[model samples]
Target: MSFFKSLFSKKQPTARPKLNHPSELQLNDIFTFGDSFALPEAMRKQQLQVVDINTLEFQHQHYAQIVGQGSGQQLVYVSFPNNPKKLIKLSLLLSRNEVEALFDLDAFSEIFEEPGNARLRPLTKQHIYADMIADEYIQEEFMISGYSHQQDYRGTQPPQYTEDQHGREFEYHCLEGGAGERSVDIFIFENGDTDVYLSFLRPANEITELWMKGE
Candidate 1:
């Protein structure tokens, strides 16, 4: 009788971790300084289209414009507070041939783990475009692959301004968020005192589709 009771017992749900600042979070290489330089941006403007993906009910209504093709090609450009004069973009574009290359490289794996930590594989440009067609595409292929989102400090990367408060600038990638739920926030600051603020949160799925269809 006790065994039967145990079999029917409900297990407790694990607690969610608290969000900390600067540190206290584990990050993956892709979210770090692993950008393909201008590769992502160039592909979006040339090979794939761009869109805005922000429609999740629970996500914060932050303005993000996602541009890319639904055929697994696109780039994500984010413009946020502090330095609102510039746009920071991240892109991924993969051609049919490129997809074949991935297979050749043995890049397809159900699980990615190191000695003691799980890792997320870097996306081929092709992977980025496919993600736009369906949120599920990237969600299943990349998001769920045990990779952590990046945390970009206040200042890093291009469009960065000179110090002394004359202007703002940040051009670097870092890790952010918790396991299973993570994101990469790229920063691009223009000259000081520019007026540009994005307050709409969008899901990448829909935005990428629109851009691909050229709508």
Candidate 2:
């Protein structure tokens, strides 16, 4: 980690800008990590926030805390209850004012893709403090029909069928829930650094499979 000691320097954190997705704008060299490939930054901003839900009133709330490092540096962790996998961690490189700017609704716009062919989009600096607030929980899913329709694949060997001889073996990774539209895909952004990835549904989006994908 490098430090800027000059009295007048450009290292200062400033007001945030609107947020946007990658392939939606131009960026320097930021990257978003994904399963298939990494993407490039399509937008830029000073901070990011969590809004929509409140910590005091909501059962499923997001909590934030700042931890001090022995080296005199600090890191902030913003965690969500609805999505256990979602957490925004930040470092001392950015000032509290910059962090505050991130929470502003007007700070960010546009999207930035990660470096390779990865399909998931990573979070950006535009994800300021205000974006950290919790407003609501929108339930969503993807629906796909399975081949066997059996509840479990226990005691069964890996189903393999030749496409030419008999038939092709296919599995369904479906979505379930009420009569509303569901989210077919999930984008996971890890670390404060713009790292991103995609989450694929398997065996009807089993919880077991979802956990394994991250590791």
Candidate 3:
């Protein structure tokens, strides 16, 4: 073999590790990073441990899916923290930068570990949910896939406009509860009723179809 070929073959690859906790949680990986990086125990004690990591190509960015689980043999909840007395599997799509920021806050455990550890907050203009929805069309999709629902709950993506019977126009949006089984759908006008989520949980082509239909 050539000397340069031998030298290049010995170079190390820079990669992040795959992790699973409890020594029993099994996770599959598309690519493996043999040695895992565990943050200090003091930082992660009550938090969920990384179970698997995958790349998502859906967006025009470095998107990822990081799955984690409780320290014991417990499963996380996908349904609303309380109503469902059992386990559930949920998936979140986030950009790499967002994940890093959340990690810095040690938010994984607080936001995901278990129902008891979750921190709830109200929505305000400062939150990400305040972004304006498309003026072109309105869209909503819901998945009670691994969840149960209350008799009256709905959600909607924002900046959605509506016209009243008397030709008055008003805007509508959802203030909370888009995930799991609970959500609120609110409208500024009198004749509005809400019961679902306005979602971008679909493909670009699919969303384009919605736009065309709305037109």
lDDT (0 to 1) per candidate: 0.28, 0.23, 0.27
Candidate 1, which segments miss by more than 4 Å at Cα?
1-63, 68-87, 95-97, 103-107, 112-215
| RMSD (CA, Å), each prediction | 20.7, 23.5, 21.4
Question: Roughly what TM-score does model 3 have, to 2 decimal places?
Answer: 0.21
Which has the greatest lDDT? 1
Ranked candidates, highest lDDT first? 1, 3, 2
Error of 1 at 146 (Å): 13
TM-score comparison, 1 vs 2, better candidate? 1
Off by over 4 Å in 2: 1-68, 78-80, 84-215
Q: Residue 157 in model 1: shift from native, Å?
A: 28
TM-score leaderboard ranking = 1, 3, 2
lDDT of 2 by residue, 1-215 (tens): 13454645666666334333221111221222232211112111112221111121122222322221222232222222233333232212334454334323222111222121222122243443222222311223222211221121222332343544321122212121212111112222222222111112111111111111112
lDDT of 3 by residue, 36-132 (tens): 1221121122344445533222112222333445546532211112233322223223344533432233532243233322332332233232221
TM-score of each: 0.24, 0.18, 0.21
lDDT of 2 at 148: 21
lDDT of 3 at 134: 20
Q: What is the Å distance of residue 120 in model 2 from its true position? A: 19
